[model samples]
Target: MLWVEKYRPKKLEDVVISKKLLDDILKWAREWDSHRKPLLLAGPPGTGKTSLALALASSLGWGTVELNASDQRSWPVISRIVGEGVFNETLSDEGEFLSSLEGKRKVIILDEVDNLHKKEDAGGEGALLKIIRKKPLQPMILIANDLFALSRDLRNHCKVVNFRRVDYRSIVKVLQRICKLEGIRAEKDALVLIAKNSAGDLRAAINDLQAAAEGKKKLTVEDVATTIRTQQTDIFKVIQKVFKSFDPEVYSMAMLLDETPDNIIWWVSENLPLEYEGDDLLKASLV
Candidate 1:
């Protein structure tokens, strides 16, 4: 369990980079109101959008409800819960508290809001548009790799915060700290290589570390070479589809092709313009 969830950031501060953004986030958390529009955290994966949202809820002692795109957002589900209840609600025998009385305001985190591509009875973009406009009881945070993919109407209703890719140096510091905690010895060069190779994704670096650390308690360059396998080229071909193709199926398959999320992103970044330009590129860049 420790190995699997070990890399999950325990606090907002633990998330690499975006310190100023985190400070502003904490301020919004202090007073969560219906007037507070849903905030879209836009950045590359492993940069800590989801982690920061969860950590904020944890620090405030509030309960967090997470929604994913895979879940059915049909009308019955939305009306009975998420829609009728204000960013969704937690029911207790005491009564339905508008905000999670778990000592802090409840936080509703919607992951992959950009996935609102298809039409659904639960109102889809239409329902969300209403929800955001109203500014529900509990605070809501939406995490998306692509902000431009969001519906123009929905985008207009919410506050969008931009998150940049974390620097290699920042990721190295995080890796070093984790090494210290795990009681593992690591050379500076090895750590730097892992950080650089991870392509600014902290999660990938941790995964690499875990894989390398498996054989030996101490990590070195040799371990990294043997443990973390390089991504295949076909992965890049599919990622090219994500930006260049307008077909929905293309987007769906592109995310889960034979490559890891981090590797796929490299292709997406590299070839996004090969298929698109201007606003499309801007929108793709947001994701």
Candidate 2:
């Protein structure tokens, strides 16, 4: 099994970051019947947004009806799937009942909600807006990387919750525990290096560790460094360094990672505001 799946968090407490956010989600679940507003969890990719949604549902003994870009997410499809799950008290795909009376709540999770604006998703957002405004019988959670990508009308119907990147220390701690469980003799420094290079993405960090530990009983810092250097530099980390440092080495580092100048420029332009402020943002843009 992939380390990411094998080590997936099963409970809210198992999530490594954002204690307050977890608490808030639990509270929301507890008070869901009274507060029928959907939750919009906005964060960067691989920051456990989907995991948190699933884990929260599991903890509450709720059934889940998940729809993503992979599924036909058009207006008709969403309406049919979501309507059945919301209105009917039948068991979900996972064989869990979908009624509050049975101590079960069906959570409708729309993953990659930012992609809802695509042509294929025509009228999908509008239908969702109507559902939220009408207040469906079941709770709902929308997960997306970019909050602003959602329509204003859709955004207004949900309670937005922001998820920050997972800290490196928390990621490293999880890596150590995984290594211990897998019986892979990994150096602390090696795990730390992997965590740092992952740019606060726990999923990426675990993948890197698994790749480095392949065909070896023990792992060293060199192993981790080699794995990272061989792969593409995380665009988020590159953006952060470019904004924080004016050194020419920033460009050199991107080049060393074999990142194309065009791709680097695009990443920098896309994420400039996230890492810079005021004149700094303008100055970085000007450059």
User: Candidate 1, which segments miss by more than 4 Å at Cα?
Assistant: 2-4, 73-79, 87-104, 118-120, 230-262, 265-287
lDDT of residue 167 for candidate 2? 91
Q: What's the lDDT for residue 247 in model 2?
A: 79
Cα lDDT tens digits for candidate 1, 135-216 = 6766678888777877777777766777877798998898888888888999878888888887777777777777677656
Q: Write the per-residue lDDT of candidate 2 for residues 92-195, one digit (tens) a residue.
A: 56644446455555688888777665432345566567667867667888898888888987888888889888899999899999999999999999999988
Tell me each candidate's RMSD, in Å, in order: 6.1, 7.4
In order of appearance, the predictions have TM-scores of 0.75, 0.76
Compared with the true structure, model 1 gives a TM-score of 0.75
CA lDDT for candidate 1: 0.69
Best by TM-score: 2
